[model samples]
Target: MILVTGATGRIGSEAVRLLAGRDLPTRALVRDTSRVPKDGAWSGVEVAVGDFDRPHTLDQAMRGVGTLLLISPSVPGQEIAVIDSAVRQGVQHVVKITNHKATPDSPVDRRRDHARIEAHLRASGLRYTLLGPNLLMQNLFAVAPMIKQTHGFVMSAGEGRFGMVDARDVSASAAAVAAAPAGHVGRTYLLTGPELITYADVAAELTHALGQEIEYRRITPEQHREAMVQAGLPEPVAASNAQVFGLIAEGDAAWLSDDVASLTGTSPRGLRAFVTDHVDAFR
Candidate 1:
């Protein structure tokens, strides 16, 4: 059995769908049973109510699970205990979702946390695959309201081009790794889209997709943090998000890779296609 954590999230949900589509015995670890879909692609998958904070629930969730898709929770430092549980439960392989810029000296706090998780997973002695994806295209959905209201989105990433990947593609890669763990063990894949595009380019794509003049409004990091806080994000999370944008503005995330295509046997989706698929959000 394959166990998927963060099963209700973007990447985890898609991974569960893909794996189940391939007839794999998949189990989803969800905190809230109500969040799991009752029908559609998720109809037949097993749902286990579990939490990383509550380690006792994990043993039941992980029982008979050989391969684990270890998607770290958004809360920091939660993955350490989750990995320990996986190790204790005798999970043979772990496919971890990490950041593309994760490293020991990463400037962003989130990336640093991912680096720590990667380190812990490495030392756990289980076969593992680390998927480090670049900026997610789904992140643009957060600014959909701003675009609908004023035909513009706000950001601090000025003239910095980063390979923005679709979350679905990352899920596809994860599914592939989970199904066939032989070739992927002990590998770190840097998943990215085919092109590197700046926020200005993204605005142009949105303009064309929505048939309106969409703009990318540049702001300072402090201003971005304040705007995020106004949008209901916590002050610390908003500051951390703004710092990531600052890193992007400094060209830290400006790169492309073929790892997505290599793993999933298909090219990653571009921004224009992503905008078209999510045109309703912008409208």
Candidate 2:
């Protein structure tokens, strides 16, 4: 059995759907039972109430699970304990959904956090696969209100391009790795879309999809942080998000990889298709 943490989240939910569709034995670990979908593709999933912060719950969630699809929580130190629990429970394999920019010198705190977890997982003696997905196209929906109001959005990622991937594709890759862990063990896959795109390019795509001239306003990192804070994000999270954009502005995330297609047997979705698919969000 494969145990999926963060099952209610974007990637995890999609992973559950794909796994269930294949008739795989899957268990989803969610902190709140109400968040679990009651019908549709979620019907066959085994829901386990678990929280990474609570070690006892994690142990219970890992019971009879041979492999784990581990989605690290936003909190920095939370994943280490969950990894420990999975190890103690004899989970043979782990497919970790990690940050693409995870390194010791990463500017973003979340990236650094993921790097630490990756190190711990590597030394834990468990068979593992690490999936580092690039910037998600779905993140653009965070500024949907701004786009609808002014036909534009603001960001700090000046001119630099990102291989923006679809979250669904990431989940599909995770499910593939979970289903067959042998060849994927110890492999680190850097997943990306078919093309690299900048925010200005995204604006043009949105313009065509929404039938309106959308603008991309480049701002300073400080200005972006202030805007995110004003938009109700916590100060630390806003700062971290601004730093990620700063890294992108420095061309840190301006690369593409075929890992998504290689793993899931399908080409990753490009920006134009993503924009067209989510046109309603912009409208």
Candidate 3:
């Protein structure tokens, strides 16, 4: 049996679908089971209730589960405790979804937390596979309103390009690793989209897809910080988001890698395709 945490989320749901399509007996963990899409109809999955804040519930979720996919919780500091619970429940292996740039040497506060989680996984003696996925193209949806209103995309990412994989691609790569019989244990996969794209480039695609003039507006990282603050995000989260955007602006996320295609046996989707599919959101 396989258990997927955060199964209702974008990437998680995609992972669940892929796992089920592969005929794996899958159980999804969501805070509300009602939110899980109809099995094999909407997204090909079934769900059970599990909350990260409530570790006791996890043991029930883990019963007979040999492998667990631990989706990083939105509540940042809760991973260690939740992982510990899964370990105690006799889960033989775990696949962790983590940020791409996270490393032990990373000084950024958020990446450091993921690094610590990786360390814990290493020391726990459980078989583990780490998926460090790059920036998600779905994040561009946050500018949907701006695209609809002004036909423009705005970002703190100036000249920096990102090999931003679609969330579905990330999900597919993750499911592949989770299903591996061996060879992936203790391995880390750095996943990216098939192409490197900049904000200006994305805007160009959106322009064509939406049949309107679209432009890229570059802002300072400080401006990004302020914008997040005004959006009602907590100070720390806003600052951390700004820091990650800073990494993108610095060209740290630009290199296109074939890890997604290699792992999933299919080319990851491109920015143009992503925009075209979700054009209604921008319209």
Q: Which predicted model would earn the best lDDT?
A: 2
Candidate 1 residue spans exceeding 4 A from truth: 74-76
Question: Can you write out model 1's per-residue Cα lDDT over 1-283, one digit (the tens) per residue?
Answer: 9999999998999999999999999999999988887777886789999998898899889888999998855454578777788888999999999988787797778878888888888999999998989999999989999999998999999898899999999999999999999899899999888899999999999989888899999998889999999999999899999998988999988999999898989999998889989999889
lDDT of all predictions: 0.90, 0.91, 0.82
Error of 1 at 114 (Å): 0.9
Supply candidate 3's per-residue lDDT for 164: 86
Output the better candidate (2/3) by lDDT.
Answer: 2
- Give the TM-score of each candidate: 0.97, 0.97, 0.95
Candidate 3 positional error at 64, Å: 0.7
Tens digits of lDDT, candidate 2, 171-219: 9999999999999979999999999889999999998888889999999
Pick out the ten consecutive residues of candidate 1 with the lowest summed lDDT.
72-81
Winner on lDDT (1 vs 3): 1
Model 3, residue 42: distance off in Å is 6.4
